[model samples]
Target: KPSIAGKLDNIQGDIWSKGFPKYYETYYFFSIKTPLLNEKNLFSQCLKNLSTQSPRLISTLRMVREDHNRISTRRKEEAIKQGIPEKRVVLPEIPMSNALIAFTIKGLQAIQAGLQDDTSLRLTDVAATDPAFFAGMTPKEVTALLKDPDQDTWDPLFRSTEIHGMLKIGGSSKGKVEEHLKNIKGVLKHGTAIDDVFQDSPSTPTDSRVDGWTRPNDRGKEHFGFEDGISQPLMNGIDEQEPGTNANTDVNMYTDPRLLIVTGDTKRESSIPRPPWMENGSFLVFRKLEQNVKAFEDLTEQWEKKGCESKEHMGAKLMGRWKSGAPLAVVNFYTEDSKDPDKAKEMNNFIYENEVCPVSAHIRKTNLREDLTENDKDPRALRTKIIRNGIPYGTDYKGNENNTKLTRGLLFACYQAHIEDGFQNMQVNWSNDSTFRTGHPGQDPIIGQVAQKSRGVNGDLETFFNDKFGVRQSVKFQQLVTMKGGEYFFVPSIPAMSDDLGM
Candidate 1:
């Protein structure tokens, strides 16, 4: 049997290569009903349902396709020149399903109950479990085999890495959406006309957004300041083999490489031949990264008075993008005349003759036009592709009277192959590394960590300055973004679930 990675047609949309748009997320877990969906056609029916998707997910699918095709084209050119046959070519493509997220404990239970009526469910008895495959693998190896190393392995997957907990779902009105989910749970409750495999239910009342869900803690304003999700590596036609490792910096190998290429030469060695359930399985990670509103406000205000009038422009400089997603590395601060200023202009188009915006600004730091010239970093941002899917978790911004300040921040979710190498390492080693840009002092300025050795105004945060050049620097982060709780989850392919592990 071919490995699941070779089968893109069977996996869930958000589970593997495909990612949902940035929004609040939720995870749903369900159990099979006793009578279960008719095994005679269970697998076929499930796959059919997967073909149908929510509207938002469909748009993201198109973007993923474009990226996949782009990467495929590049890889094909490279492979042809290298003498590889066209038939053996591998190009990465997005997975079909977007992994599901459930917001509360009740949400998890609700999903479990829904499984009772889920015709896609199958009985454990007659499912295609293979003893030889089981014998070839241990519990640990089986778990690893279930996850593709090349696919994005952040948030949703992080949540699954835990023994228990529910996924948080997002949308316009989170509280209202949560209630709808609870209502579904009631419909599926046991013996009241519908069947229940996981529980009798009705004992647990539905949960509401009013109760409020707490956010995660591991985020901060990258040194430059504007909320940053600025750059990410897009998928292309690259082999699944380990890309050459960088030697100059220390790399947390496990965390950095968390993405899986569903359409390319991406491959992983399963202890045994892949099963149907395991095909095209991708991991998804969701996190609620809260940004400090007060801190950002104060910081931007201080910088604005210093001859920079556009707060949005300052954000672009700090985030590498205008609120509209345009890169400041291209357009100037005052030139609002450009018809829709959101699209990023090409590098050759930008006039860098004048250093009105310092060359070492946040955008310039991460993507120095020359791939090999500045800091010798690869110019291609594909290595850092992370599908950011999150939302502003707290209430709308209010004035000073609201001291508690809406528990505001970004629901920072990213999808990458390795956590340590992708987001964590990027923050610590790349973006935060003050020494990355040669001859430039301080950090990336936007996401760079301001440490004891950090370049702050006055002697560190130790001394006070009166009207001095350093004293003019009034911007500093007061409220900060933090990560609270999350886990790594593996979205198993249908074959891996049914035949390999019998999940």
Candidate 2:
């Protein structure tokens, strides 16, 4: 038997055990050219070309080891130079460049069929079992199921074009990422035996390219001026402690590895057996959400006028956390994020039993902690756990709340074993459901969408500011975050890509 680290080396993309150093990233969505000449052998040859370039692809285990080596090397150099022990030396995190690739249902079908002659070839037997994966993201039924906006409002590439696959390249800077992307395109074009097999459409205005990056100067904060990615679930085998924090003591924050990976021993409510080809693979959900900064600020201002304590309080209630990454469940008033490292580590060590965080708050709705019965809490947590790996895109707001010209928001992405029980369940059953557990806590004020409505409805968005005073305030508002476009993809393990697809 191989170790978990060795197995992870065969899995492409970040596993969220340790977050990737992605300061900047470029997402390239392209379609495989139809009517492929010699389609039988052409597709396999193309995959072989990609497999030969595997050395350029970063695996989850390689990322962890490289990050560890970088830190250790820095500590050793500092110890020698300063005449101190290595344990005493501390350094800031260093960023690294990486690349990953994933295929949509259509792409996988095309590869499996080997020829474009058969339109009936389906991946239902050999691929993922989730119906959401088989039914692409833009279908009318899927839109209604997920409470998404009309397809007409989405980017043309995602709404109409048939996206076969995506190539993601990330680095410490924009220039480095761009250079790497150039190299990847070159390899795909010339190295492959087939020419023009995978090409971006020329008719599209956006060129099927989306650029993303962390907010400059203020790292770890989203365009909404709030700390993001603070309360991620800690995997059992891949991680011993939560990054940016000390050892995770909260039982609710830890997750079993079986919940994330596809193995023969994996068991779910569904009867479908795990495919051998997808042993270590995971389902990927990609969404391009555009945030309206000025509109959110304007709404906060309106709430302040309507008996709310303050704009910061209203924002905190909506998100379940202060802008400084401090959870409202643990703290009272909003203040500057603590500069002390010890205080920052304690931020993610609380549950929602205190009622300080609203039931309708974005985080609370997404991850319910101890809000249900003892028996239900643990089971529900296991069902909805997802590893979020996303970043901010576009520039920060420039003071004008009404400027529609400047577009900025999150390029949200998450990985999970089962799509139906994970992201979809969180969106449809939790976030969008007003009467989720106890109170009529309305929709998630930030990203939750109402059926057939262009905006969100927070019917009972309420929170208790002062527990002693018994003062509870509620406010209603429309959603600020809008889903521009998205898709569901299956990222294969490196071995599967090389042996199965490349064959």
Candidate 3:
């Protein structure tokens, strides 16, 4: 048999650390599959629980193909230039595990409606708390109402409207949004809807329970205000999705070996034991991060006059990318050449020499090849590579200026082999590491904090602009890059969900 490395290409794209391109919704979590006599029967039933509005595998393939078209054209061109048949550039054909599922309140409503024949059980309470019952209602006002513990405001969103369906590329639409999404011109016609890529949900009994899910205004932007999700890790054998790789190599540029293997799969000289379910599963962190839009805007304005230039430059410098998702690490100050296709190869082809692109920038800090040097003494950064899986939750212009409303932030979910070594340590240590800050050994400018009493946006945006000033002089990161949210969950592999007493 071929080595596991050879079988690497056989693994699906979505299961890897970076994640697949699709929308997702998180349903209420169920206990690990229980080991019982009825369990085998439930396994089949559980599989039925997993449903999607779109053909999972097909939608995934379309996304992968689109990505291939963008990243592979250059390699095809290169092969042509080298006097070689472009067809020789063998690209890997891989399937992506569909991480998204959909089971709306309407779906549940149908089930409940079917069960209405039973007069003893009242469906009233179930209908009342379900968000699907009120599909088009004001989610904000409804959210406030729902928080009142006594109010039952979730009824209407669950009552399925034809428009509230998932828009498919081929099949007939299912919901209200699905129907409109299909006819929305450039939006949902081609392959999948943009929102679908970022908003798909797991099929569970609780989806219809949502008051209404909203996308944050600053969602596409990271903590530093740059558009994110531009560069993702491509599995080595799977296919190259990131910018640079050509044919043989370029088609596989995003595959970073550090993230390929699960924690316990490989032998370690240090002898750290990988957790029990570490191999096939991933750990996710769902944080309700709240951003101070007004404060962030003001800081950008102040930094601009001090030579940071436009919002785009400051955004790129701080986030290592522009709104277009171009990384400052790869192309500093947004050069036309970087976008010229010729120079836009490796996303990591960055020159860290200049302070123009701050070392404390979110992208650089999160992916510091330097800080991750000691994987043995502390596999902190290396082990912290969890797949970020949640979407921006909240509304547009809800709390943009003032109004005291905490409008938006990420439902920050990250999947990892080990939670302790991954998300937990990264947030508590690296992201909060003052020493990791580029110049002043200051707090990580993005997610770091100053004392609670002295907390607010850093007053001196200029001092922290470049690494010129000292750490003490740097402004404290007052923005909440992430915030509190609901329960923690462990997503299981299909097998795990069906075996071992739903542990």
For each candidate, what is the lDDT?
Answer: 0.36, 0.67, 0.39
Candidate 3 lDDT trough over 10 residues, lowest sum:
165-174
Worst 10 residues of 1 by lDDT: 459-468
Task: Assess every candidate by TM-score.
Answer: 0.51, 0.85, 0.56
Q: Which should have the higher TM-score, number 1 or number 3?
A: 3
Q: Which model is ahead, 2 or 3, in terms of lDDT? A: 2
Q: Which tens-of-lDDT digit does each residue in 71-137 have in candidate 2? A: 6688799999988766446555465577777778887775666644443333664344667887878
Q: Which regions of candidate 1 are displaced past 4 Å?
A: 1-8, 15-279, 306-312, 337-382, 444-480, 500-503
Best candidate according to TM-score = 2
Report residue 98 deviation for candidate 2 (angstroms): 0.7
Model 3: lDDT of residue 186 = 29
lDDT for each residue of candidate 3 in 1-503, tens digit (9 for 90 to 100): 11224433223223343343333333222221222343233322433333222343222323434444544575577687776655334333332223322222332233223232432222343233222232322234432321211113222222223212221121111132233333332222222211222213545423422212323344244443444454444434444344453211211332243343333233232244332322333334434455556666666676666643665566565565555555565565557844333333345444355555566666665665444454555545554455564555445443345566536555555555444555545555555555654455444455553333343344312224452242222434445343433322333333332232123
